[model samples]
Target chain A: MPFKDFSKGLVKANPLFVLVLGLCPALAVSTSIENAFGMGLAVIFVLVLSNLIISLLRNMIPKDVRIPCFIVIIATLVTIINITFKAYLPSLTESLGVYLPLITVNCIILGRAEAFASKNPPLRSVLDGVGEGIGFLLAMLLISFIRELLGSGGLNFTILGYKLGEFTIPVFSSMPALFFIMPTGAFLIIGLLLGLFKKTGVLR
Target chain B: MKENVKRVVVLTIIILVSSLSLYAYYTSTEDLIREQETAKLTEEINQIFPDAGRFVQKEDIYYVYSDDGDLIGYAFKATGKGYGGDISILVGVNNDEDLTIRKISVLSQSETPGLGTRITEDEFISQFNNKPIDAIKLRSNNGEIDAITGATISSNAVVNAVYTEYKNKIKSIQR
Candidate 1:
């Protein structure tokens, strides 16, 4: 399989940097690292599974019915994840809430399955899914790391009873700038990050 | 003709296999999923009433009991229409029907993050913990509770939701 298809998504066709898909979740959930990680994994699951299923059925789906077929398949997978999360990982599910179901229209997953997976071999398609998923994850985590540290003044989190130490630096902790955690702050962060990526030739 | 038929058969087989695999995976995990949701509610209750040894749920309201099985409190969810969207909070009331406020966890909210969302902060939520039920109205309405600045609607939404649900839920438990 040509590795170019996979590598392209990392930079040249990067989901956030270049393709600019799934921006809503990127902006909304990047307030905290924990949320970003949860959203990233959820994206990975949806992207990979949707790609696999679309690739497997690419030939059989009629041209007229393809879009509807893809929608049904993607919606089904999203609902399953939504219900499963509601039942099992309730805290993450609670935090994520409607964003879980919003995965159906995330654009990245559907755009990939339709444009790449439907035309490629299953193995190549899977690799594309993984590459794009990782790219999305990388972008979100980077944004979240900055947001959490600056907005909340700490990196404190505990998952499944595991203690993550409070990483509060002296000055930032006491009077953490509240603006960094607001909606407008997210827009500013993404805009600045986009410019930084372009200026540094990270997105050229 | 034979080649076309072969391709059709192969595609059908693949679709069948994929569908079956997903169905199996979903069914097997369904039970675990329900348990996790129940455990989450229990954990939330325990946070509010740490000594809650048992509880009963009816119509989405939870009645928490102590280790001695005495009624400690009653809890129910309150949902309000806020400026951004629906704001849902879990409301807990003690044996006196006064709020014990196990914890006011935001179930869903779309208020402006820093300004309105601070309603979920302990400084705000803890105020409701042991307060009298009748005094739950927002301070703007001449009640005791203070509204978060720039978030009167958000704050009021929570206050109103809690008050409305309390009035309703407290009646059933009193009976």
Candidate 2:
């Protein structure tokens, strides 16, 4: 019942800042806040479900074929999430596009299943999954906030009939930094954030 | 020897169960996915051809009509290979008498983000409005449209898809 297992992922072993797992989606979907939110939720669903299933079946699986088994389990969860998201949240689905289904190949789920989940009980594994997922989400939101704000000079909280009034920066909106919206901006933001965290003794 | 067989059995059961469950989920959601897809296409069509009160399919073209049943315009999908993947565009033209470009909307595309994706922006797509279909080429290529800077391939891919499809559809309709 130790709570350290859940909180550990937030900072000490964050999936992005500290551990740097799931870097692909973290960068690819971090261009916009809404996309980051969608990608984060999808990862959480896949991670928690895969971790739970893997922990439950850990003892039953053969050591030699466990990798393929883990992949199947994660892929199945991703596909179901993909379909449901496409149906219920079509805008988020479209915005995230290829990154949504790409969750199947994301190393985060597989890495957790193999490293932490398989060795732990189902409840602990679920907590780790949730923790790591949240850690990834925090990193994504920070990165996306900088990227979207600087790149577009605004943030649109409205997504799929939901409106949270768009906020526009006075001067930034006129000439937003186009560099911050490109692929390279993703790297710069993450690198600077990681450096700042290290300077503040968060990653050390 | 017995251990080997047990290992094989466990793996087989896992695979069988996974496939069966995924198949069931697929079957259940297949219809809903199609419905969502149709709804998205209809929404996009309504956006491009705002006057479209109804749509009728004639061959490969979508004939749009007003509430009074007069033809408002026509729309059809055109796809071309782009840098990342196929770019599908919904190309709309005025009614048969006016086979000029009305509006062009990027229906689906997987082009490079930020760069090629600019193809979907208003500054890029809005250029197609009221232009002759024949003039939908890059300015560098001696046409009226300007290719999105740093995204010429994607811009050209869209222009080419629209041009090719427009020609083919026009020829068929004229015949």
Candidate 3:
């Protein structure tokens, strides 16, 4: 049963593709795989924790003021992650910039809090958060892989500010399509992916 | 009325708990954040003035000195309002009478990814090196620097900021 809760987030109700939530960070930070990964990790951390807390406090939180109570919890979690990143991963913090703090307002975290966590038990809610978070992460990686490869003509991988490896395609590296890194590219890619997902019956 | 009281009490407790946790975390990490910032500044200063052994900070300026304790040059941060946000630059000045620019390193920026952000690239920043501070305008403005092709505003922001801040800091240095 817990596995079902987690697995549903991975495909059945994928946050970015199916639920269509948290498109802001998905579009803005998907310019690079590294950035996308960093954003995904942060979201996962916030989502899972927020879900657990909100679930545990579901009964204690009054219905009339649950939204504000959830927000306070989510915002607190976001701040904690932001500070942690700033201290230990300064480079990622620099790259993530305002988007890191903006996680407080991300729809996925709040959406899960209000829709799933508020009513579910703590264990189930946590699984849901993990599933949804990973779904978002995978979606971000897919979009960014396309953008960085076609837009920048290469893929430069880094983890925690450490250079892992990098490779550039010959012709693409010389004169890549610059638009792929722009906001237009983000919209184009996501729109096409959404269409493709529908055509292949991934969305249903 | 009784239900309303419960709602208020619940919300207050949640907020109070959140605030206290945030307070604890921020206070604990404040020193580490400050240290990172200082380390970054030191690294940028060293890059701009590689010969310098030490630096003294007065207001927003750094007085850089060589290993022999001779005044090497002066370095200061200049901020320009770019297309996306404030662009920060560390401008180094030669100790000569003209106060020619030694080098400039973009410390941080939030400009457009591929266009306006080119301000941080060597091709754009290297143009500032060894030029008279007074001549830090774009070619169209009859000055030395050339603006980035598609990023005139961002390029101009850097040039204008460096020029204006240089004028201000030079006055203090002369005093």
Candidate 4:
């Protein structure tokens, strides 16, 4: 129904690049492809659900207390997600650790709730949520694909007792650069990609 | 005054609905999460005591038994302040006078990525197998265990946790 509204979030108003929001999880969890996608899925779940709820309640909430109301709703959704992940995906639960719960504070969710969902209709808000989520997901996957490939020298599809497969470069696996897997690597790669995007007119 | 009352009523209703939903979900899944935690602990315990037939736990100690019902040894957990956060160590000891560590595994840690997380790697955790209490310290402290490079704090945290907890646990078990 809101098809036009959804597509813009995928690139133009992309949260990670043009908006430069939600950088904390983008950087912290982008060490591996597995974490990146895993984090992305969790964000999408929260984003879509929270956006829909906030849109429905938009008319009822007073401007003075709107921020606190959004916080409450977002925090509740994140807690539900946190417990669900812990129960169903214990391995991911461990690897993700604190960042999973820290999703409660992710600015992207709060930002969308206030800026878009509060002003938009329910269907349109849901579109924005999906578009933004996919955009964020694509950005994270790109950053981590490069990080894991260059840093760890491979991409892992391993998830809760399931390994689709892995491809590795033997020499790199044995003596990897190791920088891309570190905290500093996140900054360096994101910086380079951001610059490239700007230079190539992918971002302006 | 009328507007303020309406705002309070609406916010209260929203909170009540949110909490009720959470409670409903929690009641449904609490048992499943508990079972998962138990299964994980059992798996970790089995890895520590290879020949263990069945284990009985009391006050945080797991009493391991052989297939024929002989006491193989005991295992317990230890905690230390790590670089990232608290590090939990599972210590398996043989039924010997010295209670030398039969093996050890880093149960949980929040250490830094790449460098510190390597402590969970087989190369690092395997070093503690069959080492005496005295050998639990790092090589720098004149013990056998080598600290993982760039993660000395995490390595030392694991070492000190097992060493201290083992000493205290063994003393109490003997008494």
Winner by DockQ: 3
Give candidate 3's error at residue A156 in angstroms. 1.3
Write out the backbone clash pairs for model 3.
Answer: none
lDDT of 3 at B121: 94
Q: How well is each residue in A1-204 modelled by candidate 2, as lDDT tens digits?
A: 647778887889898988778889988889878888878888988999999999999999888888988988888898889888877787778778889889998988888999999999999999999999998888888899899899888987754447767898997686678688778988999899888988998665
lDDT of 3 by residue, B41-81 (tens): 88888999888898989988899989999998999989999
Clashing residue pairs in all predictions, respectively, total: 1, 0, 0, 0
TM-score of each: 0.83, 0.89, 0.95, 0.93
CAPRI level of candidate 1: acceptable
The lDDT per prediction is 0.80, 0.85, 0.92, 0.88
The total of clashing pairs for model 4 equals 0
The i-RMS of every model, in angstroms, reads 5.3, 2.3, 1.3, 1.7
- State which candidate has the highest TM-score: 3
Candidate 2, residues B1-175, lDDT tens digits: the string is: 8778878898788888888998999899888888998888788889988877888777978888888899878888999999878998999888745588999999778776558888989999999998987688888878899988788899899989999999888876521
Q: Across all candidates, what is each one's fraction of true contacts kept?
A: 0.24, 0.50, 0.86, 0.40
Query: What is the docking quality class of candidate 2?
Result: medium
Put the candidates in TM-score order, highest first. 3, 4, 2, 1
Model 4 root-mean-square deviation = 2.1
Model 2 chain B: ten consecutive residues of lowest lDDT: B166-175
TM-score of chain A of each: 0.93, 0.95, 0.98, 0.96
True contacts kept of 1: 0.24
Residue A133, model 2: Cα distance from true site in angstroms: 1.0
Q: Cα miss at B127, model 1 (Å)?
A: 2.4
Q: C-alpha displacement of B61 in model 1, angstroms?
A: 3.8
